[model samples]
Target: MRLKVIIPVVLISLSAGVLAFTKLGLSDDPPGRYEVIMNLVGQMLKEGHYQPKPIDDAFSKEAFNKYLRSLDVEKKFFLKSDIDRLAPLSTHIDDELKGAQLDCFRNINTIIKQRVAEASAIYPAILSQPFDFTKEESVVLDVDKVEFPADSVARYEAWRKMLKYRTLEKLTDLQETRDKSREDSVKNKTDQQLEAEARDKVKKVYDRYFERIKNRQDDNDRFSLYVNAITTTMDPHTDYFPPDEKRQFEEQMAGKFFGIGAGLKEEDGKIKVLSIITGSPSWKEGHLKVNDVIQKVAQGDKEAVDITGYPVEDAVKLIRGNKGTTVKLTVKSVDGTVKVISIVRDEIIQEETFAKSAVINGTHKIGYIYLPEFYSDFNDRNGARCAADVAKEVAKLKAEKVEGIILDLRFNGGGSLPEVVEMAGLFIPEGPVVQVRSRGGDAIVLRDRDKSVQYDGPLAIMVNEYSASASEILAAAMQDYKRAVIIGSQQTFGKGTVQRLFSLDDFYPVKDGQSLGALKLTQQKFYRANGGSTQLKGVSSDIVLPDPYYEVSERKDSDALAWDEIPKSNYEIWSNPVNTDNLKKNSEKRMANSAAFKLLNENLATLKKLEKQESYSLNLATYKAEQKVNTAALKRYDAVNDKVKELNITSMKVDLDKIGSDTTKIARNKDWLKARTKDIYLDEAVNVMNDLIAQTLPKMQRKQQ
Candidate 1:
């Protein structure tokens, strides 16, 4: 894959009040494993990293601050006094690294252990007391806006407020549920009883939470986190993975996992769903979404288990199971409502994560190919490759005599750089597709040497904010050649840097059963053949469209590499360039007049306004009123999805053989085709192709003939 950005999912489960771990007593000396890894990491950064910063006191301070944040992101554990005590060693970390000592880490680890033990006592005491929800107060949920407590008394007071807020949140939820239903059972319960129940529920969640934190983490995990702090200081994309983390990273990149098929992360001390893998059982079930917090997990016919405090890895173990078994998740939505979702454990092969084609019935037959990622099986020569699969799909479309083609790359976060070059060649006469420049090396153009143009017809490439890396390269190349009209989001995700993974064991051999993990280091930057880099500034779309995801872009990422241009690569422009200026003007006019687009814009505006909110009330009245307003506003946008357009999408005949025997595949394909009819972006892409055929392609084809 070309610069595969690995997002590690950390989920762990705990048994009651205990977490499984091997704790090391604090010592002034660094552990043998840590000493070896740290020294090697420093060497690797200096030699292997493309943009290595000076390993001076400034870098040391950055790493120190980063490590502290990782240890306690929500400012709930360490107090201001603890921070003050640790402050003196901030610049000394550079000296420590150079001398192969870790006095600072040893002291910080000891302090954290004491604080965790103290926190274990503090949470239950606070939760056991009755919470007065009627109190007029607000808790600053934004961690960056708040400071650490001054001392033990102040820390407990902060804990009290946080615990009260949690209880208040649950109390409001319970009261609202009763108000909504007015059921016989719910109506019988007194407000006091309901309030007490909510408090108990919050306590149970925290009880398990504190227990897991006290137990699940080992010295290795802590050491790994410290190493990552150092690595990530180089850049946001660069990361150090512990052995287990490396295994998980490989599993995800392989496009399959024997689990519930949900990506997870620890956010604000809760396990939040990062994403539901496409074709996974959880995705098929459709109850989960990004940002939803998983509060509890239960096996089939077993008592529900609280997992709120569990480490992400431990929680993930509880979620993963033998195929066909059922795991139930109690998921809290983004808006605070909670529900139970059950998904059967299954092997997620990720077959659907590759390229898939369907024929869209329009005035002119149009073939639509959806590439989720530029995937490839590097180990197996005959294994699946996205470019090869796309070529096969195009050949199938050619056999069907399709008049035009649309490549849908929305939310495709890129993979396999070589595969992208091959895929780009399929649409145009082969030439320089992209330029790669490594540190201390000359810029080399990655070319598609073959002169064959496979699908040189009316074409449109659809993208969104999540389209990135290899996605940017392919789109930028096609745009540069004027071979196709790029449509959809304002710009694609601007990740143009390349990364190479190095196994830590390769540098230094470890003892049997011990692992040092892997490091993903940025090694190069990619530029378009026309000389423009798609780094921070992504490939701009020809026909811009309103998208809820417009807020997401590389510009928001503070650590992203800057945009710069290199010398233009030698390449010929397309013989028949597209009329993008005319096409864009027509699309803008249509978007202005279209009702669906209008509603989409309104929805995006509301979403963006909501995104600005940083504080929330602990008072039930104010919270509910605000939530109601947001809910009502969201309901107005439901029409955006309900409004269907003219799209007669059908599965390819070639896919029939693949889906004939598998009912799951058939059902998935059916759902996919149904969703396309309601997709405004796809609707616009099809229209763009129609416009191309009517206004642009005819003249170009005549000239070529």
Candidate 2:
């Protein structure tokens, strides 16, 4: 189980900061603008908190150089001339930043507007030109070049435009290809008719693209650009929040949001249902499923509006409404068949965010504590301390006399660092838990101040690829201390950098004099005492479990930061050493013989094969074929449930409602046990713990005898 960190207030502060920046009133003239910009830059350079290194003239220059290098034409996407034109401006920006001059804002705004105009003019030409890849000389620059800019806004906008144009160009090409295919399919068409059809198709494609570009020019793009500019100056974590997005950000951090009870993303030019919240109306109706693409949305009894190629925000607006209103969605499943689903808008309560626990086995009573996030309300001092709640659960488990514990951290993305440190301390006696290295070469060892270990017995931590940040810190600490057996998936999410938010309003003057800009700046790097940086190389499990991630994905293979090394620190190992090799062998043997494990492996294999599929045609035969494959996958999943019944495992009951609301009470009441009897991982963990106990308990008992 990986831990997820929640930074609720940060998002609010970021939004406030952005508003401040946009509202800042610097000056009417360019020199006065430069002065204002310089003053702002100087203040940030001197006082802005950063997770990486502190901002300085030298640091700014180095970053600027990196930005310039990234713009080389021989690079993957950017042109060399762009870098050449931008590099010299770095010094002015750096100086302005160093001096805290308000005038720098005007200078930056002017340069950005100019560069964007240049890029916009060149964009059509770049798209129209044909790439002669076969010509060896044509591919001029290496893709690995880096470019850094001192003016954060200019640099970010340039990259954003570059990427956006590339995406648009690719999408246009796809549309053209589809159009040509349709034109060719028309039977017995005259030359004139074919020409007309081709022209019409081209016109439609152009219109669609034009609409998309126009929509992108709206406030969303402006807000996004402003946010990115602020983030680039600070650490990546700090971001300016637009007022419109504040509510959504709050919902995300709180693990709850008011909407249509569905997660949406653009897929294949259509709004698709990524996941329906577990308790939402859609999930309850069982009409919406993953991979279902939404085609249209209609208000109560209103005509459906075709939403193909619609911007995500616009689509979201159509889907979201005040509670009690009905919204109808037309969806196309993976099979290419369409269906209509009507759901009333309502508050979606996220059960996964709350504290949930499960008992592993009836007799051994190994407790499973799943803390999704460290979420406390800003209004309350102890509102969202997940660690404290978990501690209370641990007390209950101890009273029930559980033999061991499994801390599930699979989807935990991380939350509060302090909460994580305190949680880690719960398992081990007071000691240094993690090491933080600052930019100025200062190293601090964060220790668990608690005098006593909450649960000193055998422990196991279950994590997956999604586990990140504070979760990684706790897991790394546990691994270092040898206090818990790390299990499941591959390596956890490798986000090791810390971030701090700064208000841009405090520096730059806003035109409106009402808004502020906030930057989430990366300040420091976290490291395990053993010396490996968790930045991109997340912690590897001690006892690797059979998971879909192994076949479908690898942690290091994902798009993440590069793994780098930092200085090592002296720290003590907290737990007695166990033979990891023996543990692995034991687990492997048990899994090989277990029928449940075999079934799980077969299901995972089928899932992997299905996941490889990408394209689907509109033809009926092709759609049916796709449906057959999907049906087969569904059957396989259903078969697992039947297999559970065959095993006669009383704990494998399918009634979710039977599971008590109070997880702690469920752990106590042995009669209502369901998960323990059939849980393969818990059974295995118990066997391993029992073996260890058998080996060591006799020595202590012999003295008493």
Best by TM-score: 1
Question: What lDDT is reached at residue 90 by model 1?
Answer: 86
Question: After superposition, which runs of candidate 2 have C-alpha atoms over 4 Å from their true positions?
Answer: 1-25, 28-217, 222-240, 244-351, 506-517, 550-571, 575-579, 594-705
Choose the strongest candidate by lDDT.
Answer: 1
Judged by whole-model lDDT over C-alpha atoms, candidate 2 comes out at: 0.58
Question: Over the stretch 606-670, how does candidate 1's per-residue lDDT look in tens digits?
Answer: 98898778777777778778888898879978878676475888987778987777665677788
Error of 2 at 77 (Å): 16
Cα RMSD, each candidate: 9.3, 11.7
Across residues 1-705, which tens digit of lDDT does each residue of candidate 2 receive?
Answer: 111112222121211222122223434442333244334434443344433345555555554544333222323223345446655555554554544342333443444445544544443443343322222221111234334333535444444434333333343344445556656554344444433343444445444544554444343444345334433545434444543354445445555545677878875456888776656778777888888989889998999988887877878877876678888999889998999988887877555575555555544456667777665333246444577778977876776676777777877887666677888889887777777765555567777888798887777777777788888898888888877778776677777876544544554545555434344455567778677788877888877666655522223433233566756666667645444666778877877887767877888888877766543332333444556777777786656544442111222232235554755334533443454455455455566655544544554467569
List the global CA lDDT of all models.
Answer: 0.80, 0.58
Off by over 4 Å in 1: 1-31, 211-215, 256-348, 550-552, 644-646
- True lDDT of residue 139, candidate 1: 79
Clashes of 2: 86
